[model samples]
Target: MRNKIFQKLKQGYSHLGLGDDILQAHAEGLVATGLVTDENIDNVVNTQKSFLESLQKANDARATSAATRAKEAARKEFEDAAKAAADEKARKEKEEREHKEKEKEMPDWYKTEKAASDKTIRELLDSIKTMKEGYDTMKDENDRFKVEKAVTERKNLIISKAKELGIPQYRIDEGFAIADDADEAKIGEYLTKVANNTKAQVLPGNRDMFPLADKQPSVENIKSIVDKLCPK
Candidate 1:
């Protein structure tokens, strides 16, 4: 029975990575001290194996707990990273949306200015069309008189424009007679060409520059001559 207990203890200690030689030496010392006997040898072996098993169970539980903690930490890190990426994407999208919205909006001043410009153009076009229609529908003597009056008004406007451009009255009348069938735009073009041609012939200074020998120069005329000689 003692041999059987020793063999069982050796097997249990060996399975727990304790060498047989060490176990044998320990058992011998216990026996020499009279600590182990045939009556208690089996109980001693059982107690030692139970202690070793408990130690192994404790080590395994510690390993499992460490693995669980590491996994939780990794999962939390991944979730945080994913949340940060999502937040960045949302922020960029919001900025882009606001930028597009800003681009789509026009200023009140620009809108008002454009509306006014469009209205003015429409009114001008309508006025021109109405004038053309009235001219085309002439029938009676009164309608002919209205047509003549309109023609006279247009001629007067052309004469005024030509005078503004420094064109002589006789030249303006001659040009009108030559382009009597032409529209106002054509007449304007002719006047512009004439004005450009006559620019080189225009002399500098006023009539005071060529005063008659009999006429004495006034103070204003003398000041004008001094201004030309030594301009401010």
Candidate 2:
């Protein structure tokens, strides 16, 4: 069947080259080696179409594979990114919890140091107040003692200071008598007054220091002794 189609195709081409023969005899048998023929052209067209269809099918499969691989990679990347985000959030939350716990912690030193500092300040203030009270009390006692000594005895120190200033001891005694109130607590007032009035520096036995008697002197008696000793 292929030979019959080849013979017909060759005869058709030979007839195309006839010049003046209205119906000349065609040398169509030579079509078997002719370069131009319908059957061979159609076969080449079919073969090229088949080859193009194969190449297109192969390209379609390669495109599908590339798309599938791209999709799988994209899916894996998205999953990894989600896990990283979750891990980061969890880490931040854990750190915040730890920070809160640290904030709540307290040690013994923190409590005791503050307590000791407060106590020391309080003690120092109390000690300062006590020392001020003691100093004020001592000042009052010392002033009272001075008044009592001047009233109760001839201050040998005063007499000595008076003699250095060329003042007589009698004048010193008279000055002291003027200042003395002769309170009963001062036991030596009367005897000192008597000794000053008599100008007798020495007296007998234990009475030389003007000892207290069993009874306190009356105000009038004390006043009378003072008037005689000073006269003013």
Candidate 3:
């Protein structure tokens, strides 16, 4: 009967997947307690089998709970990682878009400086052009003034020399009209010829017509004659 109980306990514990060492320890403990008997042997086997089944069920429940906890943790980790990656991607895309926008537009400071520089260049060019025009105009006026001064001096010299030669005003006027472009030497020669012609035109016994032909004229007589002939 003891052997039959031992066999039954071994078969039952083995079916419950208990290790050899645990089954041996439990069987030895039951024998030391004097619980195995012909009358209670089947009851002891059934009771031990029932206790082992309840323990296995509790272990399975804990293992199932632990597996569920681990699966939930893994899913949360995956979701958190996915969210972080999406946020990083969005941040990089936003930065790239801002960079592209910056590339399309120039800075305000640079645009303002360039515009000011262009304006200054135009003003400088205009100033230079205006100065050049003013210089040219002044040069032309100066040249015209010099020419007019030279012509006036030449006319004054011719008139003075003609008066000194005692040439008549009418003859001097005719000479001035004909010798408009004559130099000092030509004017002097022309006045000398007119004086000689006046001396040669002295009429015989016409003393009044040739008074100055025989004698050198006084400065006052020449002035009086010139004033009467040429007036103011």
Candidate 3 runs further than 4 Å off: 1-105, 174-181, 202-232
All models, RMSD in angstroms: 29.6, 41.1, 40.9
**Per-residue lDDT of model 2, residues 46-165, tens digit only:** 333444345456767888999999999999999999999999999999999997786558577876786799999999999999999999999999999998887445555445444444
Candidate that beats the other on lDDT, 1 or 3, i.e. the better one: 3
The lDDT of each candidate is 0.70, 0.55, 0.76
**Over the stretch 1-232, how does candidate 1's per-residue lDDT look in tens digits?**
4456557777767666555665666566556666677777777777776765665577678889999999999999999999999999999999999977875697888778877999999999999999978877764667889989988888787888788777765566675543557777787887788766554333233343445344555666666545533334
TM-score, every prediction:
0.33, 0.29, 0.41
Question: Candidate 3: lDDT of 62?
Answer: 87
Clashing pairs in 2: none
Better of 2 and 3 by TM-score: 3
lDDT of 2 at 207: 43
Off by more than 4 A, model 2: 1-39, 107-232
Model 1 alpha-carbon miss at residue 104, Å = 0.8
| Per-residue lDDT of model 3, residues 62-133, tens digit only | 889999999999999999999999999999999999977875687889778877999999999999999999
Q: Which candidate number maximizes TM-score?
A: 3
* Residue 97 in candidate 1, Cα distance off native in Å: 0.4
**Distance (Å) between predicted and true CA of 106, model 3?**
4.0
Error of 2 at 148 (Å): 87
